[model samples]
Target: MAQSDTVVRILDTAEALFAEKGFAETSLRAITSRAKVNLAAVNYHFGSKKALIQAVFARYLDPFCEEFNQELAILEKKSEVSLEELLEVLARCTISVPATKGSLSVFMRLLGLAYTQAQGHMRRYLQEHYGQTFLRFTNLLKLSSADLPDAERFWRIHFMLGAVVFTMSSLDALRDIALSDYDEKTRIADLVARLLPVVTAAMQAPVPEQPELVKQ
Candidate 1:
């Protein structure tokens, strides 16, 4: 294989391993062995273990982020669309290719890793990459629910995303008990349509907080 092909194979092997088994559990030797490359080749291609993991994410995340941002732009350009339309677009962006469980699951597993790892790199990535977009999303929510305060808006954004991630990651289990007519391929649109109302309604009203009493 060409050197570039070797690098790609290493990343593919690493992404699956790291996603399923996690970074600490997945070793460089295991990755090289699976990719049929040598330890030196892994270093030459990626330089280090961290670089490889980041490359694995970049392989999937960068494209999805660009596509989702472009889709958001197009949605905004369209005249006076409903909140539900926006929600549906957000949901559909996730499963761009239903057949490729590799991409979507990889992302969720990466997210799981970031959550547990709690490293500076993941923190920086979230703050710089995802957090900026997250703030932009807050502005969009403002368009629909202009009255909400900053704190509420922030949590609501997290709430909607939590809904999307959990649901998308677990769609198959939900489908098994679902009506016979339902299939992930055919019914995702319908599924998003149904979810939009509940999500939008939840965001529409002012989020209430429990009263804070001073502890002596």
Candidate 2:
């Protein structure tokens, strides 16, 4: 195989295995075996397991961040961007990014694992590489909800990510249920359409008053 083909094969195998088994659980040997390449190839291309994991995410996120940043730039040119518009742009850009078949669920599953799994290196790597895009998105979110306190906004942003990760990670299962139980065929776009309003409403919910602590 050509060097580029070798790298692509390794990445594709690594991505699927990582999504299925998580970064910590999936071994480099397993990835090499699945990709039909030797251990040397993996080391040559990615150097280490952590780097391999980062490479897997880069395939998906690089394009996503590029599209997201462009959309945010366009929105920034407007007088003001509404909370709903910001979220809609996010959804559109996410869905519009070109990905291989069945890779969307894989991408979301790996994302969920990134948060749920205890991989400090992966977290730090993501922060170092993609933190700027995340910060820009968070800044826009803050601006859109200027009325909310900073602490509240922080929690809401995490809550939104939690909802997205949970829902998209189980997308295939949800689609199966929708088709079987309701006799409805749902596309990813349709699911995002249903999800955006709920996410927006949750983000826009009134801040609850803090209750006084009772004496022990």
Candidate 3:
């Protein structure tokens, strides 16, 4: 096989395994075995497991970030952007990315794993590479929800991320449950549509006044 083909095969195998088994549990041996490549090939191509993990994310995130930044640029030109409109731009950019190796659900599962698992290196890699795009989005969010205090916005933003990660990572299961329980077929786009308004509302929620602590 050609060098690029070998690399793509390795990446495809690693992405699937990482999404299924997570970063720590999935070993290099397992990845090589699945990819039909040897340890030397992995080392030669990626140098280290940490590098490989970051590469896996880069495959998807690189394109997604490019598209996201473009959309954000257009939105930035507008005089004002609503919370829902900002979120919709995010959803549109995310869904527009081509999932070559697996479904978007797999991509989301890997992302959730990166956040939930003890992958400090992966977090740093993301922040280092994608921090600017993330900051831009967050700045736009701050502008859209200008009413919210900093602390409240911080918590709400994380809460929104948690909801999205959980929902998208478990998308297949959620779809199955919807089919079995409600006789309804759910699509990924449908879920995003449903999720946006709920998160938008949460982001736009009224900040509650701090209550006084009672004496013990």
- Per TM-score, the best of the predicted structures is 2
Superposed by TM-score, candidate 3 places the C-alpha of residue 104 at a distance from the truth, in angstroms, of: 1.2
Tens-place lDDT per residue, model 3, 1-216, is: 334988999999998999888898999999999999999999999999999999888877998999999999998888998988999999898888978533687888888888889999989999999999999999999899999999999999999988988888788889999999999998778989899999999998788888999999
Candidate 2 vs candidate 3: the TM-score winner is: 2
Local distance difference test values of all predictions, in order: 0.70, 0.89, 0.90
Higher TM-score: candidate 1 or 3? 3
Worst 10-residue lDDT window, candidate 1? 97-106
lDDT of 3: 0.90
Query: 1-216, model 1: which lDDT tens digit per residue?
Result: 233888778988897788778888999999989989999998887898877877776655666667678877886676565667667666666557333544564666576676667456866766776675555555565776667887787788778766766665555556665755553453556666677787888777666875899899
Q: Which stretches of candidate 1 lie over 4 Å from their true place?
A: 1-3, 75-81, 97-99, 129-132, 176-194, 214-216
TM-score of each: 0.77, 0.94, 0.93
- TM-score of predicted model 1? 0.77
- What total of clashing residue pairs does each candidate reach? 0, 0, 0
